[model samples]
Target chain A: MDLIKVGMADLAVCKAPQKLITTGLGSCVGVCLYDLEKKVGGLAHIMLPDSTQAKSVQNVAKYADTGIVATIEKLMALGVDRSRILAKIAGGAQMFNFAGTSNIMRIGERNVEAVKKQLEQLKIKLVAEDTGGNFGRTIIFDPQNGQLHIRTINQGEKTI
Target chain B: MEFENLNNLQKDALKEIGNIGAGNAATSLSTLLNKRINMAVPNIFILPFSQVVELMGGAEKPVAGGYLQVSGIAPMSMLFVLPEDSLKLFLNILIGKPMSEKIQLDEMDISVLKEITNILAGSYLTALNGFTNIEFNPSVPALAFDMAGAILGNVLQLYGEVSDYALVIESIFMEEEKEVKGHFFLLPEPGTLEIMLQKLGVVF
Candidate 1:
């Protein structure tokens, strides 16, 4: 099976027999979208919640608002049906114990909210998610089976 | 300040900052441990966000990270990171007892780690202040013992809004014959480097 790796503030899309993976998501989130009929998948590793907060949008895959939309568009451009698209997100962990102390501390929660909000705005169904914790996660999405594999340092691997 | 547009002289200025800052930090650490710690002159790297995890020894590598927000006229993010064996050595020095590499840190250990960051961060900023007269104040250091990519990525995310490129000043600290290894990363916020450079009369 072919493997496509998505880096921070980056996105990738692939068809059947290809897999998408992103590693080490702390406050950042990894958005995985799979097409049920086409067996196509797209993954975006987003760093921030919204693009409006940035002075300039250098990379669309860096924010939840723009990154989700960009991922969906890329997936659709690959001939996947928008109606058949389902989302599974992982990461967006606090990664630290300092609660409510700074803006970056709360960014994990904000990114989760923004991603869900963006998915709703675009009318995409969020089928599964493993998010919001105090640990880091590495996720892999298989396009053939639409199974998202999540891994952590202390926590064992699980497929959602 | 465009990160890609920095000239050689501007880059040298950045390297000097790393040299002086790390020099001060190593002294504080040496005093704390009651042993001599040697640090090489730091490296100045201007890299894209995607390549940062690789800079930290890949995404899944375990690391003990100290994250701090440097707030002043020029806001920035600062980090002190140590690998597993290195962290074990560091904790062993602090508690005056052998620390197992597999053992998890307790609340008391976390406090010691956080306080160490405070000392290091203070020394770095003080050194920078002496150079550019920029009064950079560091916030309470936050500790994370997790994947290197996670801690490093989150530190980069502190000013993720406008940072397409990270200006990282990286320094390595070692205790006699490289017994311990640690890294200090001083990531100036977007445009902060330009201000510091201007203050130092270095035009790019």
Candidate 2:
């Protein structure tokens, strides 16, 4: 089985029998788009919420909105229909439990919201999600079964 | 003003700043334990996100981390990480307990860990304030026992959106003998390098 690794602020597209994995996702959200019929999947590990809100950005994969769109475009180029694409997301954890008045404390929630909004904009149905909380997650998306396997240090592992 | 434009001398100034911070932290720990502890001279690296994760010993490595936001002349977010073995060593030395592998820290243990982080970060920031001759107020310290990459990635996101590279000052704490333990990281904000340099009489 081929496993394609997705780094932070990066994305990857793969087919059936291949897995897309991203590790140590704290506040950063991992957005996955899969075409079950075609057995094609793509994962985008996004750090921030919106690219348009940033002053300057060279990596579109660093933002949820842009990263999801970029992943969608790549999946489309792989002969997967946009209408057939389903979304599964994970990560966006606080990593540290702190109550600060700064925007940093809420970035995890914001990233999750931004990712869902992006999927909605692209007219893709979000099938499963594991997000929020105060822990780290490593997620693997298998295109063959269209299941996201999430592993955590304290919470153990589960398929969503 | 950016990190890339920094000359050798300017970069050295930042390393010197990191050296002072680490030294102060070591001294603080020494005072608390009533024994001498020294830290290796810190390294200043301006690396990309992937490199940062790799430097922390991969994304899923379990670690004890401290996160504090320093607000003032040289605004930055600081993270102090100690791996599992080091944390065990700290528990043994600080509390003198014969521990098992499954360490479920009670309230007392949590307090001790929090105090250790406070001493390390408080002294480090104080040295920075003295070096720059400006105020550096640190917010309330927060501690997490989690994966290194998770803690670092979350903090890096707060530093703003611009550069592909993140500046990190890494220090290794050395106790008796040559045993090296714990890591202290200072992630300065986007313009923080320029601010710190200008304060140190190095202007581009």
Candidate 3:
């Protein structure tokens, strides 16, 4: 099976028999959208929660708000119906924590919230999610089965 | 200030800064561990955020990272990383304990690593301040045992908002006898580089 790699602050769309993979997500979120009927999947590795915080709006895939929309659009362009698309998200981990840190340090939680809000706004049902912990995650989405495999150090692999 | 527009003189200046910082860090590390740590000449690169992890071997490579957020004068972040396989060796040398490969790190082990990171970061920052006469205060060091990409992502996020590329100064160090190796990364926040260059009297 072909594995399409998604880099940080990037997105990719692929059909069945191909898998979408994003690695080393820490405080960053991986938003995976899969269309059951069309057997298409799109993954976006977003770094921040909002694009409003960005100095340049050139890379939409770097923020949860814009990255989710861009991924949905890419899936729709591949003949996937908006109604048939469902979301499975992962990552957005704190990675490390300190006492009395500010809200900005909680970017992981914020990214998860922002991505969820965006998906809800699009009226897309969020099927499953493995998020909000103090660990990094590497996720692989298999469009053929609509399965998301999350891998972490020390912790065993889990399919969501 | 665009990194690509940096002239050779500017690049050399940055390299020298990295060298001096790494040299001090090495000295402190050697004293802490009671071992002679040899550091290679620091290499500086201006790369897209996506490619920063490639320097650590790959995005998915598991490693132990020490992260510190620096503020004042020139805000930035610093990272100290060691490969998973070398962690046991590092711990054994630091604490004089027989740490096996399969043994998990306990709270004490993590604390030891954090203290070492703190000392090294302090030494690095002190050297930079001495050179440029600028002040930099670092936060308490944080430790993470995760993939290189994940650890680096935290530091890169500060710059992701303003620029697609990051300026990275990497220093590789090894204890030849023990075969232990680690990498140190210094990343200045957006526009901080300009301030640093100006402090050193390097225009443009």
lDDT of 2 at B22: 91
lDDT of 1: 0.87
Query: Which portion of correct inter-chain contacts appears in model 2?
Result: 0.71
Q: Can you write out model 2's per-residue Cα lDDT over B1-204, one digit (the tens) per residue?
A: 566666789879989999998999999887876666878888888887867878778998988888888887668888888887777777787887566785565677667877787778899888888878778888777778787778888888875477777888998887876443778899888878887788889878
Q: Which CAPRI tier for candidate 3?
A: medium
**What's model 3's lDDT at B159?**
82
Please provide, for model 1 over A37-128, each residue's C-alpha lDDT reduced to its tens digit, 9 standing for 90 to 100. Answer: 88899999989999998888979999999898888889889998888999999888887766346778888889899999999988999999
Ten contiguous residues with the weakest lDDT in model 3 chain A:
A96-105
lDDT of 1 by residue, B1-204 (tens): 778788899989889889998999999999998889999889988899878767678888888898888888899888898888888888888786576648587888889999999999999899989988988877778899988888887888876787788888999999986888899998988779888989989976
How well does each candidate superpose onto the true structure, as a TM-score?
Answer: 0.96, 0.96, 0.97
- The positional error of residue B80 in candidate 2, measured at the CA in angstroms, is 0.6
The best candidate by lDDT is 3
Model 1, total clashes: 0
- For each candidate, what's the DockQ? 0.74, 0.73, 0.77
Clashing pairs in 1: none
TM-score of 2: 0.96
Listed per model, the TM-scores of chain A against the true chain A are 0.96, 0.97, 0.96
lDDT by residue (B1-204, candidate 3, tens digit) is 887678889999999999999999999988877789999999989998899999998989988998888989799899999987778888887787686656577899899989988998999999999989888999998898888888888778878888888999999888857578889999988788999999889997
Off by more than 4 A, model 1? none
